[model samples]
Target: MSHKQALIIYNPLSGKRKKHSAFPILLNKLSEIGYHLTVNEINEVNNMNNPIRKACTQKWDAIFIAGGDGTVNQTIQFLAEEEFRPNIGVFPFGTSNEFAKFMRVPNNIIDVVSVIESGCITPVDLGKFGNRYFINIAAAGWLADITYETPPFLKSKFGELAYCLYFFKKLLFKKPSDNISINISDTVFSDLSLFLIMNGNSVGPLERLIDEKICDDGYFHLLTYKKTTRIKLLFHLFAKLLNLSKDLSIIQHTKINEADFMLPESISLNLDGELASVNSSYFQVLPQHLNVFGSNKNN
Candidate 1:
């Protein structure tokens, strides 16, 4: 078969300076591998989706994104809605490229490019919230509020540490509100503190905190927490910090293909890494919605 044409969508702000410098070398290696490559930088808001849609119209074989989870989410949203969906690839340039971890893509630029040119494809499930798409995790309540309140500068300097710092800050001041209700696979639960819907095993490379969650399982692992004492909350936080999911008594995990949340107050929702405030939200799993290009043997 002829080598597939690839469109690379990248976020220039992702990663450190050293990783950014290696982009040219990666492009050169891809060119030598008999694949036609087109690269575009995601500079402004909503810039990533336009090029991907245009590439689909041009009949490209695959769309390779070289950013963090948020960029990958944007690309998937476009592909999932398009008439012709192309294969996908992730270069893992962002701070926490969780999808890349699921696909087993190496952080090294050369290895990532080689994996893409190898022409392997895996059909992966995607989670949809309203009109957008997320491939890693969707969270709401206190966690989402903290994510939105965290400063960009802190994230740039400390990466995942920003999340940790913000988590403590929110927990100290924010009271657990029982204003939310969740319906998962027809089972309904009311008066919840927080809810995390995961497409992957872990949220990021923070394996110690997020646990070992798999992405290709065709269903979402939903974790919900009820209002509890401060001491219990502290213990649960420590358990997550140590990757001890079983010890965290405050958390409840269930698997479902679809879920909806009704909240009395406006709650912030984090889809992948992007944050938005919504009063109510619905999430559904779209199995095999994306064709991912990577080095996994099963694919």
Candidate 2:
């Protein structure tokens, strides 16, 4: 068989300092593996979409994204629109590679490259929120506000710790809203505090926090927590930290293909890691929309 042309789009600012140091070694290994590869280093954030367009216009077998969730989100926005979508290969150099966890891609560069060269592909689902596409979770209410409120300097220095610190800070000052209503298919749930819709199994580093049930079965999980006091919120947080499902008493969980959230007022939403908000929002699953290059593992 002829060699496949691959394009590697990476962000230099992602992952740990040590992981970033492995780039040259990864490049050498890719060369040794006989892939006709092109490497594009992303300096500015706006430069992300341009490379995807350039790669699409050329002859390439796969587009390898080597950054965090934000970079992957940007690349997906472009690829999902194209008439000819090439296979997507992921190098999880991001801080929280939630999508990579769902796809079961190893964190090591060599192992990831081996999976890519293995030539295996699988059809996975994608979530659509308004006009954008999300591969992991799209969250609204408290979590969204916390993510947006996090400082860039903190994020740059501490990575995922920024989110943790922000979460605690929000818990002290921010009160959960009780005016949100969630409509999932035939069921209508009123008086929700938070709405977390997940397309992947894991939300962050810990696997069992969100939903440990069924993640990649071509459906999105709808997790809504009832409005409660800060004490209850603390309990829930502890439960998430401990991976205890029984402590999730305030949370209502279900699976659905389509859902809508009607909020009493405008609120922010977090898709992957990007932030946005609207008074009303709609979500639907794009069954098998993303052709991810990875192992045959069932998410």
Candidate 3:
């Protein structure tokens, strides 16, 4: 077989720096499979508005990202707009790893290396928020802030627990829910507490939060939680997470290709674990926007 070229983009701060150990192993494995590799630390490179965009601007056979959802989110932002984008390989080293989990990419580095060798690629849809693209979710409301505000030191020490700690603390002193308006295909939803534009089945610890079958369905799901008390909203979220009941009338869900939102200045959307603040935003689904390496089960 002919050799192929690939790029490896990683974040030093994600997932307790596990990538530092797995990277050399990945290098060996890729070399064994005849892949010529180029490596860039996402945080270290300062040129071209960060290395992810600069590296992705070139053509290659594949690009492997060894970081958490935030790193992958940055990489996709550039690749989504490129015509000669390479196939994506994600080594899920971040907290939650929601996009990789939704894509069914293996959690361990060993399995990911094998998947890369197998050459299974799946086309996946992405949610475009304004000029940005998110692979897993775009969220707004009280809970969204936890993803970005949690200190990096806490995440390094506690991993997922860091998010949980911040969550409970915020829940106790939670502010009033924003009275937001969203228009999706002529339907308007107002007075929503939590707004989630989901492209995948999981968000943070909540898995299969949306139908697993519709993950790549060319349209994104807009879920609005009615403005309710924080305790009640938590109950509704857990109920949905457990699939505990069918009478989830408190939550409104719709699938659409595009939507418009009017949000409060205080509320910002969390796109794949990163913060994006906007008073008004437009969201659209780019169907099958990127190709990623994953098991056949995901396809």
The local distance difference test score of each candidate is 0.72, 0.74, 0.79
Q: Candidate 1 regions off by >4 Å?
A: 1-3, 44-49, 206-213, 240-249, 277-280, 295-299
Clashes of each: 1, 0, 1
Model 2 per-residue lDDT tens digits across residues 162-252: 8899887887887776568877666788867778888755667666655354445778877777777868865785676576656556776
User: Model 2 residue 125 lDDT?
Assistant: 82
Which candidate ranks first by lDDT, i.e. highest?
3
* Shift in Å, residue 29, candidate 3: 0.9
TM-score of every model versus the real structure: 0.86, 0.86, 0.92
Clashes of 3: 1
lDDT of 3 by residue, 143-236 (tens): 7789889899888888899999998888888774688788877878888888887876566777667775455679877788888877788888
- State the lDDT at 46 in candidate 2: 46
Q: Distance from true position, residue 132, model 1, in Å?
A: 1.8
